[model samples]
Target: MIEENSLHPETLAITSGRPRNTPDGSINSTISLSSTFHAGGVVGYGRYGNETWTDLESAIAALEGGPTLAFSSGMAAISAVFSILPVGAVVTASNQGYSGVMTLLHTLQASGKIEVRSVDVSNSDEVLAVLPGTALLWLESPTNPTLAIADLPRLISAAKDAGCGVAVDNTFATPLGQKPLVMGADIVVHSVTKYLAGHSDVILGSVTTKDPALFSRLEDARKIGGAIPGPFEAWLALRGIRTFPIRFEKAQANALEIASRLSRHPKVDQVFYSGLASDKFHERASSFMAGFGAVLSFTLHSGVAEAEKVCESSKIITHATSLGGVESLWERRRKWSGESQLVSETLIRLSLGCENVEDLWSDIEQALGNA
Candidate 1:
């Protein structure tokens, strides 16, 4: 095998964590389905570990430049991180982050287990103001739905100076786009269900950390909490990751094209995408990431009713919720009850896929025209 560390991310995605030659010289790693192993072994029980899960974790860890632990779902991985916090811990998070994360924080706050403070992570001053005495600073750069980019380096630096740990949700910008550990984040989280498992068939999550202690704690939490991914899901995720590089590249290209068109459309009030030259976060994003990612949002001039009409009128694009699949998806953000109030009713979040740019544009244009 080649030295994966010296190679680029696109190369690493194809080559890393592959099994050595088996007895029959099989290229893919075998999925071990044993529930219990012999006593006194490294993996005594299935809940604790699996060969398939280990292979998947190793592959993702190689990409993230750290050790990784896999979980049943993205929320489970996030819950594992929060499980490490002591009762009454103070956590500062993005005000307009993923709705699921915000709901979890609110639930914990309601139970009095943790105190959550929400802030605009893009504002360096606001982030710095909340960092003092904070146990953890949770970040989601190029935030979901809104596509607002956070000043990660600045926030990470200030958090470190204040003796706080920083965790970045790297699902939007996969390790191929940005390496949070290299940029000084203490932990990086991913929804493997998204880009990592590009087919949208598997539901899994992972967390990677450079710190050995943090990795151990998260692993322990996964084991004790029984939030482990099945062998099949791990195997599927590993398979999906093999083509991530090319899929991401194509999707990002499509997204940039779509965003450019949307910005000039008469029906569009505003387009939010870091990839655009006119975007406020364009410079910062260019400085930090390999690409601006495949997701973008735009507000319709005709408002919420028209947004709904456009979503229904689409022929090629799927009107769905989650993103980062091989097929394009778009939805009105406010359609989800849990979506942030900051996300305007007219805003439609688009998740570009590996579709032809002209075909996608025609579908969108027709939908907009009909609306």
Candidate 2:
């Protein structure tokens, strides 16, 4: 086996999960559709394991520098992490992030399984105050919709000192952007349905960690809970990962330019992208991550009605909810009732794709004009 640190991330993305290249062997991994293996292999049952899933997990683990577990969806992977927490665990989480995660925490709190304490993750002092009794310090640096960035290294260190396990939602900042494990986080989770799959063709999630015990517990949860991904989805995700590095690089470049232009637009009141020098989190994100990422949020001079019009007016940019697809997409985040009330009703999230920069800008300009 090659040492994890021996190769660059770009090389690892290309070579990590390939099949042997012998004379007759396949160059790529095959989808093993069988539900059962013969007598006594490590994978005795289909629900327990699959070769395709293993290939996908191996690729993701290499990128994140840890062992990994694949799940049916992003929510399933997050649920697995919560499943391992002790009953009545006290959890500190970001006040603004993916609505799905916030909703899950709310449900768990209502069920009395865990006590949820929400805080502005960007404020280090505020987050540290609640760390004393927190079982898990859940974070999302460059938080969803609002794009609020947290000081990850400081928060991770403080959480560890407070005897809390730190789990970072690394979806917005992919492994290409930053490796949270290297910064001392205990666990890193991803909505692989986003950037990892690249094409937006599959729905999958993954959890990665350096801790073998946590990996084992999550594995057991996957087996018992039956939140495992199918062979086809795993295969598709792995295929997408092969081209991830190149795709992400192009998209990120597009986003940086777009954020710069949007900041100067007449209709734009605010642009929440760390790539811009004027953004509140620019310096922090510059120090914490390799790239500013491909997704951005902005608000118009008008209110929610104008934001909705911008989304509806886009021609090249699809008006959709999910981010991180090769085809550009945008939406008014607060249109969904499940979205946090703290998010401004006029904010629009734009997910950059591998499209020509001028085309994207022209589309945005027209949309803004139409709105």
Residue 304 of model 2, lDDT score: 80
Model 2 bad stretches (over 4 Å): 1-4
The clash numbers for all candidates, in the given order, read 0, 0
Candidate 2 clashing pairs?
A: none
> Over 4 Å off in model 1, which ranges?
none
**Candidate 1 worst ten-residue window by lDDT:** 17-26
TM per prediction: 0.98, 0.98
- Candidate 2: residue 298 Cα off by (Å): 0.2
lDDT values of the candidates? Answer: 0.92, 0.93
- List per-candidate RMSD values in Å: 1.1, 1.1
